[model samples]
Structure formats: C-alpha cells, structure tokens
Target: MANGTGEPAEYEIYAIRYGTNETRLRGRNFILDARPDDPLTMDFFCWFLRCGDRVIVVDTGMNPVKAKKHGHTMLLDPVATLRDFGVEPERVETVLITHMHYDHTGHLDAFPNARFHMQAEEMAYVTGPWMGRRWFRHAYEVDEICRMVQLLHEGRVDLHGRDRAIADGVSVHWVGGHCAGQEIVRVRTARGWVVLASDALHYYEEYERGIPFAVAFNVSDMIAAHDRIRELADSDDHVVPAHDPRVAAIYPSAGVGFEGRVHRVDLPPRLP
Candidate 1:
C-alpha cells in the first residue's frame, strides 16, 4: 500500500461512530433540528484517512471508561474499533490531534508510533491558566490534558502553530473557537477534497448561522474559523462537520459497536 512518498498512495475515509448522545445545548439554541429527532444524539466518532502507505486517524472519540463514570455511554471500543478496520494501532504513524478536548484526544496512547500533529496555540491553551479555571474548565480532562503536555515535553508530539501540510494532499489548518488551537485536517481523497472539521464547527448550523460553539475560547475567532472552513471546502457539501450526524450517513460506516470498523470514508448519499 506504500506510494511514492512511502505512504499509502490511494486514500480512503472511514467514519466510526464511537459514541452518540443527545446534547440539549447543541440543538435548542445551536442549530436547526427539523428532523424527527429534534436535538438528536448526533454521531460522536473519529475519522480515519488511509493515504498512500500511511494511516491517519483524525480524532479519538470519548473514553468509554471515563464516560461511564460521568453517566454517559460510548458506542465503540477505541482499541478494537481500529483493529476491525485492519488498522494496527502500532502501525498508525501519523495522528492529527484536532484539539485538546476530552473526546478528540482521549485515546492518544493508542497510536504507539504516531507523530501527533497539533496547533501550537492549542498546546498553549491547554497548558495555560485558563485550563483549570471556570471559563475553560468543564470541557477538558485535567489528567489527560497534563498527559498531552507531557507528551509534548517528551518530544512525542509535533506541534504546528499554523496550517501546514503533513503530507501531500493532507494539511492541517489552525481553526480555533472550539478550543484555543483547534484545527481541521484536510485530505485529498480520490473523489475530491475532504476536510475533517474536528470541532471547528460542531455542526452545519454553526456555519449556516455564523454561531460559534457555546464552549469556545473566542467567539469571534470561532466565527472566523467557520468562514475559513467554508472557504476551504469551497462548497457547503465539501466540508464535513465534526459532530454532525450527517457525517455518519455521508461516510461509509464500518466496525461493530466498539470494534473500531469505521474507516471507510467513501462518500455516501446526502441526507435530503
């Protein structure tokens, strides 16, 4: 599967639904919930992009163990889920961390050889004073955040301050608001362009209405990021919302509940 760059030449995207739950904040005030399940438990999963000879995981879903302690549920087993997709954890050489949020970076330890890609500002936010205080406390896990910081100190993480291309057709853009240095990963799939919105815009509504996520460091920056995502996508359909349920339907669904089978990212029919 190795290509010219010694990475997987062909690209495939898989959508793994690791968890799902209803969020009152995301719907009633966040966006349009015209579907039967108004304020539906949108798809909460990670994305996998296989390019050339490399396998890249966009974000890791929530920690099921920590989730249960908090009275929440998870849909996939982080370890088994990727294995089912034929992706060996140790084989994942590149892991692009979208942000420092609990859901996005929980399973960092899973990718043994992964060279994590993240924004410098994101690292700054997670390690700064605002992390433990009220305004920015609830969204992150203290220990995990600290662990990521340690990883950075140990040189296991590759922090990117601005948008940079990790590989050909795969680039990381600094899109904030969801978190200080939150970013979106874009890959040139065989079909066309695919941008993993990793919380830059939680759902399509944010982009549609120009509203930022409730848990944001800077509302104005979030709004600007939304515009940036739209512009990068070129077309509305070209962009993919991180937590949107539509993503589950639009990308090929893989893996059993918790078995890690969601890496088939081929485009699916749009929801009408």
Candidate 2:
C-alpha cells in the first residue's frame, strides 16, 4: 500500500520496554494535586520504527549500569533487546532522539553507523544556561553529551529546527515542555497515523484530563503538546505514551513469551 504522497502507507512500530521502577510517589508524576495515597510509577521504554527500508530508533535507552545506579531496575540491555527483535544496532542508519535526557541518550554509541536526528534547540538548551542549575543538569549525563559532541564532529548529527519529515512516512514535531527540545514522532501505520508521544504525555490520564506532568520545563507547553499529539494521531488509541505501563496491556504482544515486555504498536489496539 502506498500513501497518497507515494510513501509506504504503513510502518511497523514497536514499543520496547527496557527498564522499570515500581516505587510509587505522590505528586511526582502529575502537576495536579491528589490524595496523599495516590500512586505513581513509571516504565522506561525506547521505540523502534520500521518504514520500508528505513529503520529509525527513537531514544537509545539508558545503559544497565547507569540505570541501576539511578535506582531503576534494568530489565534488559536495550541494544541487545533490539537484536532479539531482529534489528542489528550496527546496521541501523537513523536514530531520532526526542530529547537529551539521560534515559533517552545513554546508549548512543551502540548505533555507530547511524546519523542522529535531534532538535537544534534541545542541544542549545542542554549546553546552555539551563544546565547551570543542578535540577536541569541532574536529568542528563555529561558522558552522553560528550559522545553526542563527538558524533557531531564526525558529521553524524542532523539537527532540525522545527517539525519536519525524516523519511517518506515518518515525521517529528518539536514540543518543548518536558524539555526545551522535546519532540514526538508521527508515523503512518496500518491503523493510520500513530504519534509516539515521548514524554509529551507520560500517561493516558495526562492527555485525558489535560494535566501536565510534574517534571516539566513549561507546564503550558506540556499541555499544548498534548493537544498537538491529539491532532496528529488518528485517535486516542493511536497515541502511544512513552512511560505508561498500561500500554503493554492495551496493545497486542509482539511475541508469545515477551508478552508484557514488548508490544506491537503498529497493529490496531485491542479495546477494553
């Protein structure tokens, strides 16, 4: 099938869960106030997108060592997990980094042959005044920034200033809220256009209730990003939240054994 624009009509999108933290804290994930007993937990994920001959990875998850040091239980090495999914990191040619947060940029070196696509403003924000604050600096790792710079020197970083298409059926839109250059990915899939809302909306509830996540660069921006996600996706089911554990239950499993760990987002979602 071909999209009217001559691109493949659909792509296969996979959400690979690499790590998770079961600890719950009140008021940590949502900006709105809740009861003292309200629970909040987060899952860590990296998305895999295959459109025609193009294989684009969104965010190379944090390495196991750093994940453990930061109190997150590393389920599996993301690069190794990708290999299990039949994707060889060495052969991957394009990597779309939604932002430079530690969890999202830690394993950049794994994809040695790839050109990293990132928002130019995100690079400036991480390297500029915001980094002077401990709060902002704490979310990123110095080594990852160094590696990205090295890649830049090697002529492998493709910086985009705003929304643009990376391939025939794949595009990225910048939504600066969770971070200065946070962006969400939109891909044409069998179910229609699916938006990978990478931290733009951490959970379905965030989008449903119009509440911004607690950790945000700009609350208003976060809320606006939610709106943008809704506009881009085919429907609510077509919007995949980055850290929502419920996604595993909602989407069909990729394989029999890796039921909750890996999901096939390219397929039509199973309704409640």
Candidate 3:
C-alpha cells in the first residue's frame, strides 16, 4: 500500500460515537484535582480506518444490553453505523483491540471474519491473577474474555509484543497505563499522521494538563504514554482523544445527517 513517493498510502480515519454516559462524575476522570462540583461526562467511540482497498476497525463499541447494564446509553448499533458508512462489518479483515475493557471489546462477534489484533501483554494482564480482584474485574466481562480465549484457539487472534504495523500506514503501540496493555493506534492520513489515543488519553485535557485519568494501572506509564502519543502524531490536532465530545465539534462531519455521530478525523478539521 505504498504511494509513488514510497511512503505508506495515507488512510482515512473516522471516529464514530455510539454511546455516552451522562452521569456526571464531577471531576472524577482527572487525578490530582478532584473537583467534586465540576461535572464530567464521557462519550463512547470506535474508530474506522480506510486505505484504498483495506479497511481497519479500532475498538468495537459496547452492545446495547451491556451498555444498559452498565448505565450507558447506547446511541446506535456500531455495526449498523459502520454499514451506514459503507463498510460491511463482515468484510473488515482487521480489528484492533486497544484493550479488554467491556466497552471496547463487546462487539467482537460482529466481525466474525476479522482477525483481532491485541497486545500480548494485554491478554495476559486481563486473564492473569490481577482479574481475581473485583476492582480489576469490574471493568471487564467474563464472557467476553472467555470468548477471546476461544477465538485464540480458533486462530482468529493476532497478538503482538509491542509496537507493530498492522498495515501500510497503520500501527499500534503498547503504552500500558490505563490498563497493563492499553494501546493507541497511529495512521498516516491526508492531514498527516493521526494518533488515536484510545483510553490512553481519554480527553484532550488529560494530555494537555498532564493529569492522569482516575483509573490507571500505572500513573508513570500513563504520563509516558501521553508523551508517546504526541511524538507519534503530527501535532495536537492530529491526536484524537477517545472519549472527548470536543472531537465531534472539531472534526468535519462524515456526511450530512451524520453530524455529531460520525466525524472524519483524517480530513482537515473544519474549525481551527
């Protein structure tokens, strides 16, 4: 997928918001300044990447049943949303699992033919002894983890040790912090390299203000991951935060009627 210039072909990256949690946490997302009165809410998103003939999917959004169980409002079926965007979920060959969080891995079954790419350490972290503790297990669903194990046996799982390129212009980097094996995806786009900081940096403010998210396996690693995200992206604008509503406002809409629900990150932003 190289261009005439020998660089990997630039891809189109889209961030699709499928759900939101309106329950205000009041400054719970950021550490070090627990403002109990400052309300905080987060949007749930899954990213899509397209390059010529190849299509790659980032985290799969949570299913409606699970969303309701967890107090999140599922806006739309992510698979259906992809179909609306002209991507057939069944035809997608590569699915990137940033981490094992329930929201990110819930729809794995939606892409039956895709090989799931995940950090090797992440799989170990989630299935290892740490999960025995309720705090660690609370964020994950046992059935999903078990299904991944089943997929591994079926030869549908691809695990990587660290930073690895999944495609011509797409790569995943292990920045273990939010979780022991949390990763961020980077892809070359028309606007340059865009880094999808999935959960590694949930909000733009988390990276800009040097504040770690409240739930982190390693605070020092989270801080280092922030640096890595900046280094990988062309600029701050090229770094897409996972849960920030501002992403929808900053990027151009994918199409008319898709405003706020689907934003095109690969294209130049509509707002400065």
Candidate 4:
C-alpha cells in the first residue's frame, strides 16, 4: 500500500543475532518427544523495523548478566549491534517489546528517546501475584522488571491490549502462551506480510512439525498461536520465528560485515 505521493507503506525488517545457546537438546525445546536426542541452536535476537525515515525496534535482547547466567554466549551487545546498523539507540523513537521475558526486556534504559510499547497484560503479569510462584517467574530478571516499573512511572512505556497498529503497515498481536502477555509483530514488506513470531514459535519445526515449545504457560494457547502466525504471514517462509538459526541461512545477510549475524527478514527467503 502507498500514499497518494506514491511511497509504499512497507517496512524493512531485520533479525539481529546477539546471543546464542547451542547446548540445548531438541527434547528440551519441544513439549512432547520429537527427536529427543537431537541438538539445537537457540539464537537470541532483537528485530529492527524501518519504513522510510521511521525506525522501530522489537525486543531489547538480554542483559549480559543474564546471558552468562543462562549459558548463552554473547556474540555482540544488542545496542552495539543496532549501532552497527547505523541506528543509534538515543534516536530510536519507538520500541515494540514482544514481552517482559529476561531476553526481550533488557537495557530499557539504553533507548532513552524511545517509548517502549508492550502488552498491558504483560506488564501486569510480571507484577502480579502469580509471579510469586517460581514456575511462573523463572525467566524474568528482577532488575529488568524494576527498571520497567521505573519507566512506567516516568511515562515512557506504552501498553497495548490484544492488537495494535504500530505504524502504516506494522502491528502487534498478543499470543499469550509462552508468557501471559507474549506478542508477535506483523509488518507489511515488499515480499508481503511478515510475522515476527517472538517465542510463540522458537523454531520453524515447532510450528511446521506440529509441536509447541516446552516452556509454555498454556499448551492450548501455544497451539492456537501457530494458527495466528500462519494467518498473519503471506506464506510459511514469511513467518520468522524468534530463536531459529535457520533464519540466517534462509534469508540473505542484512549488509556488509553483518553476515551470519544479522539477516533481512523483509526479503523473500532463498530457495533450498
């Protein structure tokens, strides 16, 4: 879609790999038993969305402290990775946080000029009584949640309900399986609509193989999210899962010096 002046309402999306853990067994990733003995690469990433002169970031990546604690090796600091893309954190005006998980909510203070958009249910879920249970609060970092609270009081956080249009061709939808307020981003691109399936489907096989991720809050919601992801993308390849290393192999690199680290998700995937 384009305005009368003829500028297309399409955004360029990038999945920037910042951290990765290759020690996990496939059984640990899937809920049921699917190739229980196979090894898997679980990459950590924060997405970048740009349309014309407008820029929007998705997920902030993990704090270094959390990265070490989880045994996830840090390839590059996420903020620095954005700088590599020529996007200064200070100038970023909009950040769409996929959820309040430790991996997605770090360095809220990094983008001082940006308003963090999150699902209201997520903000509430992190602060609510259910957090008292260890099972419900395992992946959250207390410091990050506290920082979010501080930002909330400072009026720098924008919380949405179920679905919200971010820009001309960008939107976010709450899936609520991996976490109470888990969300996925959908952006219109030159190839077509693309869905950023943040934690809803960590690997393509999780969706394609009809198996949900293991760390789910609700299995039913997780299964239903697969349908939502399919509905939002133009094709199967258009849906980009949050933690798959196959992403880099499927799409071309973002640019020079970023090969294997960052890849453009807005472009059509390469054929096998």
lDDT of 4 at 259: 90
**Model 1 off-target regions past 4 Å?**
5-10, 23-38, 254-263
Tens digits of lDDT, candidate 1, 1-272: 34676754546777676776665344433534344235545557678887545788887777886776654568778667778768898988888888877887778888877788889998888778876777686778888888887888878899876889887778889977767888887777666677778788777767887776667787788889877777676467667776776666555545445333353555643557
TM-score per candidate, chains pooled: 0.86, 0.95, 0.96, 0.96
Model 3 off-target regions past 4 Å?
3-7, 32-34, 270-272
Residue 242 miss distance in model 2 (angstroms): 0.6
Write model 4 residue lDDT over 1-272, tens digit each, in one string.
34335875888998888889989788888766747889988998888888766789999988898889988898878898888878899999999999888999877888998998999999899999979999889989988999988988999999988999887788899999998999999999988999999899899988887777889888889989999998998889888988998898888899898898899989988978
lDDT of 3 by residue, 83-114 (tens): 99889999999999999999999899999999
Query: Candidate 3 at 221: error in angstroms?
Result: 0.5
lDDT of each: 0.73, 0.86, 0.89, 0.88
- TM-score of candidate 1 to 2 decimals: 0.86
Error of 4 at 152 (Å): 0.9
Between 2 and 4, whose lDDT is larger? 4
